[model samples]
Target chain A: MNSELPFLVELIVSAFILTGAGFAVIGALGLARMPDFYMRVHLPTAGTTLGVGCTLIASVIYFSFSLQTLSLHEFLISMFLFITAPVSSHMMAKVALHTGVRYVSHTQGRPWPSRTQRPSRDNSQILTEWPKRP
Target chain B: MLRIAVIIAMLMFTVSVLLNLYRMVRGPDLADRILTLDSLYVNAIAMIILLGIFLGSTLFFEAAMLIAMMGFVGTVAVCKYLLRGNIIE
Candidate 1:
């Protein structure tokens, strides 16, 4: 035990872990409960980004206490996951769009929703960013 | 007191694993299932780290690192497959 550490540290770490568990639970719930594939894609972000971040922090603290050594590796992994998961989600969503799978509900009442979806600058930005390959 | 906290962390990670598994089974889309697997990997890594702490050994840290590495590569491959319909073009 780190005699210098306050009692509240344990409670705080436990809370973070539980909060992560909560986010993961909701992500899974949304995955199952959502009506569409796009919606389902949104679900896992709850776990992948925020939940993993919290748990990694808890792990860092736990290991620091036990080994008295910095476990920066876990923290780095959490950051990597946060960055990659969303990038990949965007890729997956784009592929779903290009593959001609119909979205459950598009603002224009069609799967493609071109007019409403296209006018948005972000939409064009994503399209422009995609690698141009034959 | 530390034991109590460690136990709590272990239980929470276990819960996270179970929840992620639920998504893998029931998600409406393949992408969703893939993401769930990624989450399951991360959560499992965290749990293993906690177990290491609880056991007062650093051995599990290496395992966690390996799992994390595998998860990221696997996600990248799946993302590629989703994009091009073939992982190797």
Candidate 2:
């Protein structure tokens, strides 16, 4: 409905928007279908990073062209998402590791090291020093 | 074309949100639920942004940004709580 925008700009914007949405849907499908917690954890990063990134880019292009001004503000959201998505995913994965969430049998690492039998000396030292509060 | 695309995109995002909801409800592990919550907020932000674009208004950008910040902080805080059993320590 934005009449001011040219045909090519509209085409580009729509393409990007559709692509982003498709990616989001695919990611969500993976989240819903993945067999294990760790696999499910990997799916959302696809949505948060690339899916949102494409939509943000489309928004930037649409607004910048429509308003006849540089609309770089969406970059803030994009950058924030890019940085935080991975961090949050990493943290969640850490929580999974700490909680010993179950994984599929086909997973390459069949048996994760137990807390008492950590693979590294430094990690063992840290685990030993870590207080176990009841 | 653009309007149609926006409408379709909105519907897809809605479907995605619903999928996330399903995962959240059915997740067997606490970490799984938390991860679903994190992605849920991100999808919500995308929906807000799409709405803003459809309406040709910049007002929703701030709301999207706020959601981004708050979602990240909440995820991190919850993760910390799960890891150490205390958020601030």
Candidate 3:
């Protein structure tokens, strides 16, 4: 199998795979190391977007070359991932907001609106007040 | 070179899965656990794709697609439940 693949194609595929893997590792590292839920929530987008994208691109290139036919099916997974990852993350963020998950001290603006506070016509006043530290 | 790259990628993905597991277990909040599970499935898809490439087969794409669909639905469902206290309303 190795001998049949052209040297350049192998190099390209290897590079893509390694790049994707690297992004996934970095994203996971951020997830593990981040100090708060809000900060951690932002990290996985890196893995879901570029990391999966590179791997699928490598797959498309490798299969298309080796099979002598255009292999475009991998794009389906990529498209689905692109569409769904953000939606899932957004929903998760909403969950975090509704549940009032704790955030680090430095985060600007109130992380979650208080349930007792009525929606005011002028929202600027809400943003102007710093949250009291517990 | 491709073979070595696949091995290294597999190892990296394994590490990623482990790290996600750590976050899921140690996360102080429910949202954190749900978020970790979401990324964990994505990492699993990546690993499956790598395995398919290593074996020189196209069969795994279907499984990966199914996982992608199911993972998204599951994440959304859990998030909705957490947000609204009900899966369907």
Model 1: lDDT of residue A91:
71
Docking quality (DockQ) of candidate 1: 0.45
Candidate ranking under lDDT, highest first, comes to 2, 3, 1
- For model 3, the docking class works out as medium
**For candidate 2, lDDT tens digit of each residue in A1-134?**
36878999999999999999999999999999999987888899976568889999999999999999999999999999999998999999888888778888876565465563345435656778879999
lDDT for predicted candidate 1 compared with the true structure: 0.67
lDDT of 2 by residue, B9-76 (tens): 99999999999999999999999999999988989888998999999999999999999999999999
Query: lDDT values of the candidates?
Result: 0.67, 0.90, 0.89
Order the candidates by TM-score, highest first — what do you get? 2, 3, 1
What's the iRMSD of model 1? 2.9
Error of 1 at B15 (Å): 4.0
Model 3, position A32, has a per-residue lDDT of 97
TM-score of chain A of each: 0.70, 0.81, 0.81
Question: Which runs of model 2 end up more than 4 angstroms from their true locations?
Answer: A110-134
Once fitted onto the true fold, the runs of candidate 1 whose alpha carbons sit more than 4 angstroms away are: A1-6, A106-134, B1-9
Specify the poorest-scoring 10-residue window by lDDT in model 1 chain A.
Answer: A107-116
| A1-134: candidate 3 lDDT, tens digit per residue | 43599999999999999999999999999999999887898889766567889999999999999889999989999999999988998999888887788888987667647552235435577667968778
- Residue B87 of candidate 1: its Cα lDDT? 82
